[model samples]
Target: MSRNHAVLTALAFLASVLLPAAASAKDSSYGFDTDRDRFGWAIMSGGNSTTSDVEDQEALDKLKEEYGGDDFLFLREGDDRYVIRDRALIERAQRAVKPVNEAGRELGEAVSEQVHLALGTSKDARERARLGRSIGRLSREIARAARRGDDTEDLERDRDKLQRQLDDMEESSRDQRVTVREKTKTKTRSEEASRHLKQATHHLQDTMHDILHDAKARHLAEPMR
Candidate 1:
C-alpha cells in the first residue's frame, strides 16, 4: 500500500478496536441505557418509572439499592404523573428543622448559663425571687425548644439538668415569698406552687427524652443512615 493509504488503514483498525471498548465503558458508567434523553427521563421520574407505560422497574430497583427510598421524597407511579402528599410543606419543614434545632441549642445554653450565675449571686429574698422567676422562664424556653424535636441525648440531658435547677429555684422562691408575706402580716396562701412547677418541668423533660429516643431509633433503622 502507498504511505497515505497505509496510515488510513491503521487509523481504521485503531477505531475498530477502541470504539467498542469506549462504548462498553460508557455503558458500565451509566448502565445499559446510553441515551441521554432516557437518563433525563429516569432522573425526572425520581428513578421510579422511565417512560410512559414502560415500568422502568429496573431503574427504580437500582435507585432503591443505591440511595434507599427515604432519601427520595417522591414516588413515581406513571410517566408524567407523580404522587406527593405535601411537597411544599414537606420541603419547608425539612429545611426549617435544622435551623430551629441549632437556634434552640444556643438559646438553651445561654439561658442555662444565666440561671447558674443568678443562683450564685442571689443574696436577698428579692434577688432570689427575681432569679427564680428568670430561671423558670428559661426552663419553659428549654422545654419549648425540646418540643421542636431536634435534641440528642446530650441535649436532653442538659435540658433535664436545667429543669431540675429551675424547680429548685422555684421552691426556694415560694418559701421566701411566704416568709415575706407572713412577716408583713399580709394574707399568705398555702398552695403548693413549687410542686406544680416541678411536676410541669418533669413532664416536659420526660416527653422530650422520649421524642429524642424515638428519633434516634428511627434514624438507626434507615437503610442509608
Candidate 2:
C-alpha cells in the first residue's frame, strides 16, 4: 500500500481498538495547565552537568552511557546544563493524571446512574426534588467530561431530558419547597464536575506507553553513536 494509505490504515486500526466516544470527540484541555511541565527536558535537578562541558564525541558517548542511549533528544536549558530528563519522574507525573481522569469518569457514571434511578421512581414532589438535584449534578458531570475531551453526548442527552421533565414537574406543582434547598455545589471537585477523565486518561496512558516503548526500542536498536 501507499505510505499515506498505510498510515491511515494504522490509525483506523487504532480507532477500532480505542474508545469510539473519546476518539471521535474534539481535543480536550481540562488538565493542560497541570500537565504542561510534565514532558519537557528530562534531567536530574541540581546534579545535572552543563552541556557546554561535553566538548567532544567522547564526552557525549560517556553521557549516552550514563543514560540509556545516545538516540534520545538532548537540549540545553536556561541554566546552561545539557539535560537528560528523569524519565522515571516524567512517567510518574504522566501516571499521576490517570486518577484525575478516572475520578471524573467514575463520578460521571455514578451520577448518571443516580439520575437513571431517580427517573424510574414515581414523579412525586420528592421525586421531582431528587431529579431536580440530579439534573444539576449531571449537568456538571457532563460538562466536566466534555472538558476532559470525553464524548458527553449520551450523558448530555439524558441530562437534557431530565431538565425538561423537571421543568414540567415544577410548572404543575404548587409546592415551591421542591427546590427550596437545592444545593448545586459540592465539597469534592470530582463530585462537582469531572466524569470523562477516566476514559481519556486510560487511552492516553496506553497510547503514550506504546509510542514511547516503540520509539525507544527502535532508537536503541540503532544507537546514534
Candidate 3:
C-alpha cells in the first residue's frame, strides 16, 4: 500500500496491456518489405546469352511495334531475345516511396520503446506520453507520403484519430495513467502505419506487374523462361 508500490503496480498493469501491441509491431508483419523483396523477379536469359547492340536494336524495334513505347525493354543475349519489364521505372517508384517504409519501421520502434518504458519502474511517465504523441506524428507522415497523389480517406482518418489521441495525451495531467491508456492504442497506430506502407509497396509492385502482364498478354515475355 506504499506510494512507490502503488505506482509500480499500475505500471505493471499498463505494461501487460501494451506489450502485445508492442510485440506485434516488432514482428515480420511490419511494413518494411522492400519492392525487390516482394517481387523476386529475375531477367529471363540463358548462360550462352551475350549482349549485342545490333540484336538489341532489332528486338527493340519489334517490342516498340508490339507494345507501343518504352514500357518494356528488349534484351538480346546470343540467340535469346527476352523481353522484360522496365526495372528503372520500378526502381524509381521504390525510391519515391522509400520514406514511407522508413517511417513505418520508425513508428514500430517508437511503439516498442514506449512499451519498454511502461515496463520499467524507473521510467518517466511524461516521456512515455511524449512517445505516444510521436507515434501519432509518424502515422500522419506515413499516410501523407504513401498516398502518392491518390485520395487516402481511410488512411487520413486513421492518422487524424491518432493525432487527436496524442492531443488528449498531451493535455492530460495524469501522465502515468494517460500514457498507459495511449500505449494501449498503439495497436491501431501501428496498423495504420502498416497499412500505408503496404499501400506504397503495392503501388510499386503493381507497376512492375502491369508491365509484366502486358508483355505476357502480347506474347513478348514468357513466364516459364
Best by lDDT: 3
Q: Report the Cα lDDT for candidate 3.
A: 0.43
Candidate-wise lDDT, in order? 0.34, 0.41, 0.43
**1 or 3, greater by lDDT:** 3
TM value for model 1: 0.24
Query: What digit string (tens of lDDT, one per residue) describes model 1 on residues 152-181?
Result: 355445544644554455457533333333
What are the per-residue Cα lDDT tens digits for candidate 2 across 10-95?
A: 33432322222322242222422212223212212223221112223353445557764332333322323233244553444345
Q: How does residue 162 of candidate 1 score in lDDT?
A: 49
Give each model a TM-score. 0.24, 0.33, 0.33
| Over 4 Å off, model 1 | 1-69, 72-93, 121-130, 133-225
With candidate 1 superimposed using the best TM-score fit, by how many Å does residue 220's alpha carbon deviate from the native?
26
List model 3 lDDT by residue over 69-172, tens digit each. 43434332234445665455434434544554564465555444443433322234444344444444444445333433334566557655655654454455
User: Residue 138 in model 1: shift from native, Å?
Assistant: 5.4
